[model samples]
Target: MVEESAPDRTTVATVTRNTASTITAKFQADNSEPVENKNTWGYVNVTEVTDALQDTAAHDVCAPFNAPVPNYRAPHRRTIQVKCYEYIWLIKYREQTILKNEACKRHRLNLPKDVNPPSGERYTYQGEFPHMGIIGWKDKEGDYIFMCAGSLISAKFVITAAHCTNLRDPSVEKPTPDIVRFGDRSIVPEAADAEFTVESKIHRIIIHPVPNYRELYRFRLTE
Candidate 1:
């Protein structure tokens, strides 16, 4: 049987700080600062990257599959390829995971189980919980509605129930909240209100894996 060659593909690697300026200059001249184009997928020459890193410790870490370690593989001989967006996604995932873990460790709150006793209801909360907030949205008729509550988990992220997000009902459909109001108690603001409310536009919404809410609703209604 005759020996066959591997399929040729270009795999991109992270740009080094030394050549970043040069690359940026080139892109600036071309008038394209890494703009995503659905028509054409971008690629990088992995062989060039491997050859450059051959003498460095990085070559051993990211060497392509079926390639020998501590050696430079010629550009024509390497055939591994990866999409540019996929590589970006992996980097973002790693960075976000790190941030999430750090946030978890910093805000691991532990309180007594009997924090709230069976006392009579109280009307006022004197800024006891600064992180608590009210999530609000505007309906199609330009009406402000307070649907659910959320907690400020981080400076950029708000932890809230999944039901607060986009929802659909047999009779009515509702979009996700457009803004989050913090430190606001009254859903309807009054002229006599003294509390300060901070409103911020939501960038993203992450829903947690939960049991079927419909089943729970049915069970509750029957009970």
Candidate 2:
């Protein structure tokens, strides 16, 4: 605690010491005649600091952690990199004829079922072959003429061989192919086709102009 009071020619309140007291102490420090000890009384204190080498804040601190750790695995190191490529040995493989995934296996096993039949053979149900289709047109005499077999892929389309139309009906002799028949397992002539039988109208038939495969001959067959 500091005392703030009127000085009796001495005391006062201040954070710094009095300059008069410092001057009085200096006067008493060397009371001998000024010229008598001139060689021992005064000398300049020399201090040289380069690049903060003499930083007084860390005077006695041993091994200060001021800088980041050095990275020995830095990219600038040249010999740390190595490159070599060796001959690879590949394992033998077996060719697969039919690849059946879980989805395909499930679809094959879980076909739609018909509990009761309206007509024809219910035991040998056509639901087992629901996607099968027969594409044909009626003749001019009203007699039905079957052309090519196809797969009823959707409610509106059937996929069939292009040769069925390309080579056979060259000049558009038949009527416009408007219907594709599916599930045509009619055991009796008078009975309805099948419980799953359906006929969908064809808007148009799109066939790829490119053949899937071509024969190559070098005096020997190779595939």
Candidate 3:
């Protein structure tokens, strides 16, 4: 206690840094006889006041995933991994190095670089023998029966054998050749390029006028 009187009291306190302290003072009153009053006290100094935090948070943090590098190759369909637990289909395109008969050279993989392509008589590709036409006949069931093959000489006419146009079958009218389909590779089962084929009606058949050619198979043009 610095200054204490009968009715009042005063006290001063000092605190050091990085330490804790407290202040207290005594009070008294001049009564009829010896008397005492309320005492005053207060907390002093301080430890520290701040949020509970860390300068650098420490935990298990995974980095982001990166796309895998691609290994370039020829045209094909393959699977690709885009993300974790995710996959996708990828189609790569390249030059046309395969014939229609051989969809790919996978059979000859790892072969010599200077080796020739798979050797076989391949003919049924696009734009191959485009002038060839199919000579068919409509039967009683409205189905076209492929009879013979012809060649298209012009846009409106096809050249075929006269015997193909004859109703040789013993039925009422044994399916005479009356239809010609051009720009086709298959006739019965319909090839993959069937949608691009052109079909036309036979307006008339003209057989060349030759002596003794009535029963003989000869070339004829149908308009």
Candidate 1 lDDT tens digits, 127-215: 44677767667766665567677787667777766566755532223566766776654564431123356777766665545644432
List RMSD in Å for every model shown. Answer: 21.4, 34.9, 30.5
Predicted candidate 3 versus true structure: per-residue lDDT over 1-223, tens digit per residue: 6985553223222223112221112112322332211121122111111111111111111111122323422122123212211211111111111221233222224334465544884435445688888877777776776768777777676776666667576532354676787776555443324656777777776666662333333233444
What are the clashing pairs of model 3? Answer: none
lDDT of each residue in 1-223, candidate 2, tens digit only:
9988765643443413566556546765755422212233223111211112334223322222132212223232223221100001000000010111212222334424432334673333334587776665655666445565677555555666555543245433464454566776442323334345666666655645555423111110011
Candidate closer to the true structure by lDDT (higher is better), 1 or 2:
1
All candidates: TM-score: 0.36, 0.33, 0.41
User: Candidate 1 — which residues are off by over 4 angstroms?
Assistant: 1-120, 169-173, 191-195, 209-223
What TM-score does prediction 2 earn?
0.33
Q: Runs in model 2 with CA error above 4 Å?
A: 1-124, 167-176, 186-196, 211-223
> Which 10 consecutive positions of candidate 3 have the poorest summed lDDT?
48-57
| Cα RMSD for predicted model 2 | 34.9
Ranking by lDDT: 1, 3, 2
Q: After superposition, how far is residue 183 of candidate 3 from its true place, in Å?
A: 1.5
Q: Candidate 2's error at 56, in angstroms?
A: 99
Task: Say which candidate scores most in TM-score.
Answer: 3
